[model samples]
Target: MKVSTRPLWRKATLFKGVVVTLASLAALTVQASPAAADDVYGKPVGGAILVKYNELDRETGPLGCPTSIELDNPDGVGKRQEFAGGTIYWSAASNAHPVWGTIGGKWGALGYEGGKLGYPVDDERTDPDGAGKRQQFQGGTVYWHPTLSNGAHPVWGRIGELWASYGWEGGVFGYPTSDEGWEEPYQSMTQSFSSGGLTLFWSPGKNDETSWCKQECVGYSGAAGTDWFKETRVETYVGTDQVKVRAIPTRNGFNNARTDFHGAWNQVWSMAPYPKGINQVEHRSLYEQFACHAAWAEERLPGDWNTGPTWDLESWLPSIGMEKAIDPVEARKHKCNWT
Candidate 1:
């Protein structure tokens, strides 16, 4: 949901170079818009936006003739123009800088003008840590970080929203070190940030209470396992719970990675305190299915999973072979890890 923030957020935390005056922000309409989303493209636009378009390096930059007219900022006093490949934002202080590519695409997806992120405060720039590129917006930033499955993608969406609640770049998560990505089997928009990382997943496979559906939750944190070599694992969050498959590399066993798929964690937990209640049966089934999935990933990927690039399960499954279903009782003999 779109939330208004303290005026201090704009003038205080971020870069000093692009701060717009409070008086200017006060003069603009509340969430103003000059062009609708369905309007025609490549139409002529005038004023500050046109000046920025004229300055665009048409020869190399991913820009085209103005696609939308200079529109007014709904949250503040800013002007922006859309192009085929990028956008230009203008303010008295920040001038008009260009934002394009992955960052621009994400900006467009967030409703451009009407979305929660208000307006672009600055152009897209490479983050200092080199995790990836990002652009500042009124509410929060959109991050395009590198992933083991997909090279670099717009990984921050809802997780970014959760991050904002935690305190944005300053919160516990810090700036995103990796973009939120999906690992076929994982089903979460998993993203790693400066501090640590976050895993988020939504399940139509089961009811809400049993899973971390409505609330912002932190799932699992990988740690050293008993069977030796640093462990690598993936959990399938479904129904109401999750089932993890682990690769336990020991000194004796070079790449000893195995999971019975039934582990202790596979058992269904009770749903949350709610009115509608959660589906305990579906929740149990989801994790059981994950155990079979764990066996699949371990059988195929084998060895140290981290040694090479990560693959998306949704796509990788079909490429390898049709995934086989497993029964929780049969797999319990060789189940996964437990606390």
Candidate 2:
């Protein structure tokens, strides 16, 4: 046994050297392979985009699989990657957000993150109505609904703010039907919506104004006991000035009788109470009283007033010399009910 001790030592050293070599090779192979080599889709996805992709459930989720490696955004500061279902955009400020479907198409048309909309801050989400979808971006929001033939539309800037005031998709506007557009005549920015043929307009140095047509004429006979009249109402607002013209049928029960009209009808125009310092007396004598007088004068006429025709109240108010009666500045202060 003593004679063979040196041979045994050599064998032991050889075995240790082989084990170390194998260990080194194993580490090298691991280093050479992709970190995210799980590549069930055969494409390499890594970095923040990869993390988002995984969050979305990768190949099994709605995003499907990565169709392309992460690419540089035009802005150079951001990165994006395309997938079968959508694209994920990543920026240092916005982190990562997935935009897809109609909303994605609209955003792309608006120039992706390069256009006015900038980067998306949140993922695409279902609207409160549940049927529509909306996604928030740095500059604005894009909305989509299956029922809309025009696909998706964006609401942003001052007009966007006004839409938000009216309650967004859940409000009177429903969903935007068109993107922001220019109205050469008014020299204003405009956007249309799905509800009541409503459109919002914004001009330089002015608050938002809205114009909408009533789909049907509704009858109203305020507390004054005046003859019931059907009004085809169309409202147009400019700054704080609101002009509501009711085109009433002259052939109602008061055909032969006449009433003295001092101003607009005695009706509660605002659901909310008037602000402080503005009492009901001033609201009636100044705004509604004059508006009512104008309507009464219009009713006396024989042609369209008898037929329940659609007329412009703002334009008519001036023709009757009652325009001064509608003090837009005072009207803003009072919040008069021009019924």
Candidate 3:
């Protein structure tokens, strides 16, 4: 085979064009109104920025200011910026996950509205979601990072185990107990996430002995300097008349190992969000439970509602309308245009 040497700038330009073209096409496909015939060709090509990030966890903490990259020849107006993507990893943060593709154009920086897209928090607005309410996570695949090479595990189990399966089972840890406090015991849980590094800990019981307790079911010690100890806690949140949630702890660490139950620390499972229809109490409870859990977790371990001091979970946030945007990149890659 013969190879021709091409200038680095020429190659970069070529690669950028292909990506921008594909992204523009994707945007056209999803646009509510028909795209202009010459929209992609009419304008002078410009540059656009594609931001990449890992799913937020209690570990990675805040990714900081919105990632901004420039691609050429973008089109559209929202918050007056180009395209915006949100946390989309849970399923494959450490594996070959989906990627999102967006067309290059000029518009205000994308931000998160109540549910709508807004600029990054660091930009201006302090509110979490911002003004928009559609609450849609846009951008087609082409953004997810492949799983890490070598041996690396996730700190938490699959989102399903935390939300769908109800509780943990198998040969996973039971409950850890100590002289200070304790963790509840139920079924063992053993799961291997696509990410192959961080260890995941869970309790696996919804309504066990206590609403929240240490791993070994122990109580606070009346000692001095170092009285507090790690424990397990299982709590549930009921929403309107259609939602309920339970969280437990199995073990906690960036790496895997035999957990002591009560001593090992880390959030295990988080129940899936359910609809309340017309009930506000349940809705409130749902929010309360998650907030309380976030708060309690802040005290026991190292975390926060927005970002964690000890852990990072922004990458794995379980927003409602996420799956729809799961793997645009993969979807487009294997999609048969004619078929």
Clash count per candidate:
11, 10, 83
Tens digits of per-residue lDDT for model 1, 209-269: 3432233332332333334333333333333233333333343223222243344122111
Residue 206, candidate 1: how far off, in angstroms? Answer: 18
| Cα lDDT listed for each candidate | 0.47, 0.61, 0.26
My TM-score estimates for the predictions, one after another, are 0.35, 0.62, 0.17
lDDT of 3 at 82: 24
Using TM-score, give the best candidate's number.
Answer: 2
The local distance difference test score of model 2 is 0.61
Off by over 4 Å in 2: 1-38, 205-286, 292-339
Over 1-339, each residue of candidate 2 has an lDDT whose tens digit, in order, gives 456546788999999999999999999898577654446467777777777888899889989988887789989899998889999999999999898988998999999999889999999998887788899999999988888525898888767876686678887557888887876744567776776555665655233344232221111111222343343333334343444444343354224322434211332221111222334443444344435334443344655442134323332122322443445554444323332
What value does the lDDT take at residue 178 in candidate 3? 10
Distance (Å) between predicted and true CA of 2, model 2?
Answer: 20
Query: What is the Å distance of residue 112 in model 2 from its true position?
Result: 0.7
- Which regions of candidate 3 deviate over 4 angstroms? 1-78, 81-118, 121-143, 148-208, 213-339
The TM-score obtained by model 2 is 0.62
Tell me which of candidates 1 and 2 scores higher on lDDT. 2
